[model samples]
Target chain A: MSASYSTHSQEKTQSSVFRTSVCKEALVMDDELVLRQAFASDPRKGCELLFRRYYTNLCNHAIRFVYSKEVAEDIVAELFANFWYSRVFDDISTSYRAYLYRAVRNRAYNYLAWQFKRTDSMDAIEDMPVDPTLKPDEVLQYSELHQKIEHAIQQLPAQCQRAFLLKRIEGKKYTEIAEEMQIGTKAVEALVSRALTRLRAELKNDWFLGLSGLVILSIL
Target chain B: MTPLPKDILFDFFDGKATPLQRKLIEDWLMIPANEELYYQYLDEWETRHMQFFPPLDEALTQYRQELNGERTRRVRALYDPPESPFRFQRWFWWSIAASIILLATGGGLIYQDQWRYSTYRTGFSETATHRLPDGSTVTLNANSVLQVPRFGFGEGRRLVRLTGEAVFKVAHLPDHQRFVVDMGRGVQIEVLGTEFVAYARNRGQHVFLHKGSIKLDLPQGKQLYMKPGNLFTVDADGHGKLTETAPAQSYLAWQDHWFYFDNTSLSEVVQQIDEVFGVQVVISESGLARRRIAGNFKATKADQLLQSLSELLNVKITRTNDHIELRTLTL
Candidate 1:
């Protein structure tokens, strides 16, 4: 681990427990050294700094899962609040970015569970693991893949992107999604179909799902 | 497996399908092509992230800028025992602004400076000075935040978003670019080649032009021009009314520790005090919300203003742990 890496692991909080970090400066600050010292002394300060660093990115990431800004912002805030109060953050022993990204994933799943409470479509998504091997290479690869998908989706018109994101990523029931988005269920179906057709036209046979894609998405 | 009706497919996906419908969709799931497309959709979706971030943030940011001109000058005017609140305000907004500016101006061609700006905020009873990208000057008061986006007229719109209140002496740019200040209450003030003082919050937008011409655009799509010596108040409803002002110099009298209120409501007066002096002033009764206050007091401290108010209105002022109360004083 680099000298600058800090995270919310449960091991460090045996003393302080989970308290929100007070440090909320930017991540790309020129005075990184000053901030690191500050974070080491005050983990809540570290959380604040981390929040400042990732607020926008996490919001953007949540939009990948939910359609409502209110819901997305709430989900992001909930993740931060949990991260702050959770003993794990008090013990940050790794890169703050990785710890937070994983935390967001957990929070997102929880949010998804609440979002899909009445529906049976998203029953397959189990609890997320710590994934001890969320290596830099994998993170980099996924980041790049995310950028590529963003670019591809950006190429499509706005409505198609909305439908595709809602149906696929959110795993939302059509009626619920239609109600949230203020569109008819038939329109939602047509949109999903249209988005799939457009995506298929674009991908051709490029193998969007590498084995896990097929199995997981099939069940999802 | 054969094609199922859209309703049957919907019910199956929603898990509300009857046993037959469930069995049929499950059987259809056995097909490789059909299943492949489903995951492919997820994979592609997980990519673009149309799921998390939405367009509303950008829209709101735009609207926030258009309402209150992007800087709030808060005045948390207390000079007693120093506390953490003062230090927190001084550090948080300044540090955040400095950090974001670094990220924004860093050597990235992908940066849309328009989407980026510095947000400056001050806390109660505190004041600080800041410089803008355009060499303009600003003095932030307590509990105020001003956002200066990444892109000015250099690339596109020269707009700044405001949350609380601030005093601005906008530097003139020769390119004839209009520097616009956006407030939160559905008002925007466009000015150029002159200096002005502005105050705005979530629901109120007020402007006192120092020397140049400013075009005020209300959230309700009404625009008014405030010439020199003009003061305008744009309410929450985006209705703006112009009033004659003594002079631009009078607006700066508060810097000398004095404020003059001419028939302003008790609520409005209390809000100004809370923002400027950083004290929570509460009206004991709801009727005080509508009580019209007209008075002038010393320009030195908050206690002086309180004394003047108590004497004139015969209003008893009580201090509690959380806030000060103003009530009808017993004669």
Candidate 2:
């Protein structure tokens, strides 16, 4: 980073954390470097700094899997708490962003799997992994795709967006979604179907998931 | 099938891929282009995730507390401090004495800031009226505080920070400088020049424009162009609704110590009494509390209002300690 970057992050945390780095320039170091240094010296400060850096992004990523804010928060909180409790500093082979993002994604999937296990057979999602590979380029691509999908969803009508979210993200059935949204079952289905068709069309050029993948994705 | 079709990536994500398909997909992900495509498929499946936005501030606050809690427990365990109640008592009194000295010195330093804004407060049954340097008049209600800029009144932005309730009759500047009221809690009222009755307390902030138009700056970056009879109410949760036509004069009745309630619930009237008199009032009867009362009364004391309400509603008002209780009158 540039010379101004350290002063910038310092300004961000100035009101909260007391600057402890005797050398002023060291405080402006890269996030991963600071995390490693802090973890080697003081684990608590390292954890807090890491939380500040990635908490929002991780929560946003978790919210993608489990629609509820409170549930997503619980997943992220557990991920962080587990990281500290298990002392995963020695295991951080990749970048901190990759490690944290993968952690949040795994925990979110576990939550979804548990939700599905309650209603259906656990065998449907038996091979869910806890530590998926999160390469830097893959993370960037997914983030961009996430933004594009978010924009497409935003283009939907207000009620349609609500109904579609209730069905897909919250995993509500047609009848349950109808009752919650005060719409008929047919209307709920139509809205969700419209959202799916619109999303497929919007992502057609960018999607590498050819015709068959799109069909399968829409089905299950 | 060497590179594995992209369909296998979806099957892999869904946990339905066969062993051979999974191996092919894993091998494909080793290449950067295939990995990007794989992540794009994953993002497509999560399109609904953008609907709800979870604020990270509250989560981080909770996390900070947990971190501090763990650190405190670890420190206590490592130190094994002595459990001496007497020693704690001695240190507590010494700390109290030190705090008193610090506060005495701090008060003097605060009074020396003549250039900064100063707060004007009113106690119970006491109202304050002040004229600003820009010829604007402010009438602060009882148990309220208004902080106005001391030195820079007419220069830049004519700004005043308010809490509780106040009525402002702002003066119009030749230069057309805007006057703004920053009612903490993310609520701000801005105007070029206008007269308005504003109430901002525990419940929420309400603005009733008396005359002239003003632009209200809402918390969430929404601006409201309010007319003369507009009544804008924003609750603590930032949920706002504006009533286009309002009894704007009735809102300013408190300036003269006269309250006018037209079909307003007794519970709401009692809340106003609590705010005006700064007292604890308990209504025992639920029906009586919900009863819509319409009348006008002039009273500055809680006892006077209670006496008027007792005759008007045919209820018995009794004082028990500092609390006033209202119950149905027995025949």
Candidate 3:
């Protein structure tokens, strides 16, 4: 594995070097260096630069999960507001880009859990042993949870799947979906509810296991 | 463990990482500084495949407002402590009592107008006839609201606000008071003992006089007088037109659940249905929307109208809840 990894790394370094020289525009200075220096000298200017750079990217990332443009923008705005109010930049050890993406992902997950009324899952998330020193484990858990939820969505009935996607992925109102499908709003609501019930049933065991793991970790 | 290459991180982001590669990346991510490199690569990948670009100016403006609001709140918290440890208990109780009284009076003053007016509403597929205090009668169409003042309705002025369609029969007073119907958007009807049908909606403003004379106060300081049987229409763009030979009585046919269409386009017919029944009509083809039909149809419900329309036009109409779809018949 180590031998393969080294060969892969060597090949990638040569290709990246070639690609950067050919396709990429010449950047005068590294963004991180400028941002860090600005932050050390003047915090407000640093915040402005950070927001101008990452606000759109963060919103785009958030909308992939939340599906509503307004909600995505709200989440990014709130994250920035909290970042400023809590003085997180002063103590953050990771690059701002890394911290912002992870924070936005966590926040988007929390929002989805709350929106779906998954109280048990939400409790499991809150109780997840958030040892910042072992952040890789939490990242793995998030990826697994996201994959499970997506898989369960794909397994829904055709009609139920359409209704769920319209409501969640397209950010459409029930009345709008009813109008499009030529069905009543009540039918749309029923379809969405049926989808949620199936999703909850599929996720129940995973959440239980996660909660138990948290319990054991707490004991240890 | 050795650091993973950028290409492997990119592969992981694209969901193309094998278990062995994933294991190596996981081990590499265990280092604190490598996590930053992971995010930097992720950011680069995201930039290459960005799905949306949010409105920057609007978001920045909102963020500035949030920052200012937070600063003000923090300043307030620092300067104004709700209760000081050195303050007397009696003064605290007195201040609380004083604030309650002040809040009550202040709230009452702000909401006093809500108590002065009474609003009447009709739900979807429903119509209602209301008799006002001055012996005037109003028949409201479906999905409409009318607001009339509770007090002083007939004393100094008889004024009412209308949102949707309604037929008004103003009662003549011996003192010669004018009746005014405010249709919003600076359009109003002034009458003295008259019968008229007024249609006010987001689409247009239309007034058809049936009995006696009435004056229309339109937008842009324009006034027009209407004789009986005259139909005055102001479109969504505030362009006004008058038809002297209009069949004014046909406008009141809705009171009898009858619709009179004289070579009316399907689109206009659908708009009328939307106003009167709150049902949305979706025409599958633009050519179908321009088809004209001339007839008197009796339909108390939206489905009945849709059925009759489908038969008359030789088209297919399907209804579900509050939505109706019209399509050309396919053989």
Most DockQ-accurate candidate: 3
TM-score of chain B of each: 0.58, 0.65, 0.65
Q: Assess candidate 1 and give its lDDT.
A: 0.54
Candidate 1 lDDT over residue span A1-220, tens digit each: 3344444222232222112221221221223334445466675565566566566666666554343454455456556555544545545543445455655544543443332222222233343434544433233223333344445667877887887676655545567667988998778767766765565444333232231232211101
| Candidate 3 lDDT tens digits, B1-331 | 5546889877776666788988888887676556656667767877886767789998787566555543211111111111111112222333344445444655533232233345677887778998776778999988887776532355334778899989999998765668889999999999989999998899998999999999888778889999999999889998889999698557898888889999899999998898888789999699999999999998888889989998888889877686889999888
Interface DockQ of each model: 0.03, 0.06, 0.13
Better of 1 and 2 by lDDT: 2
The lDDT leader among the candidates is 3
- Cα lDDT computed for each candidate against the true fold: 0.54, 0.63, 0.69
lDDT rank, highest first?
A: 3, 2, 1
Model 2 lDDT on a 0 to 1 scale = 0.63
Chain A TM-scores of each predicted structure, in the order given, are: 0.50, 0.51, 0.67
lDDT of 1 by residue, B99-171 (tens): 6664566533212222234467676656667876566777765577776642111222256767666778788
Which residues of candidate 1, in runs, are more than 4 Å off?
A1-220, B1-115, B151-157, B244-250, B265-267, B285-295, B298-301, B311-315, B328-331
lDDT of 3: 0.69
Best by TM-score: 3
* Candidates 2 and 3 compared by TM-score, better number: 3
i-RMS for every candidate (Å) is 21.5, 21.0, 16.9
Pitting candidate 1 against candidate 3, the one with the higher TM-score is 3
Q: Among all windows of ten consecutive residues in candidate 1 chain B, which has the lowest summed lDDT? A: B77-86
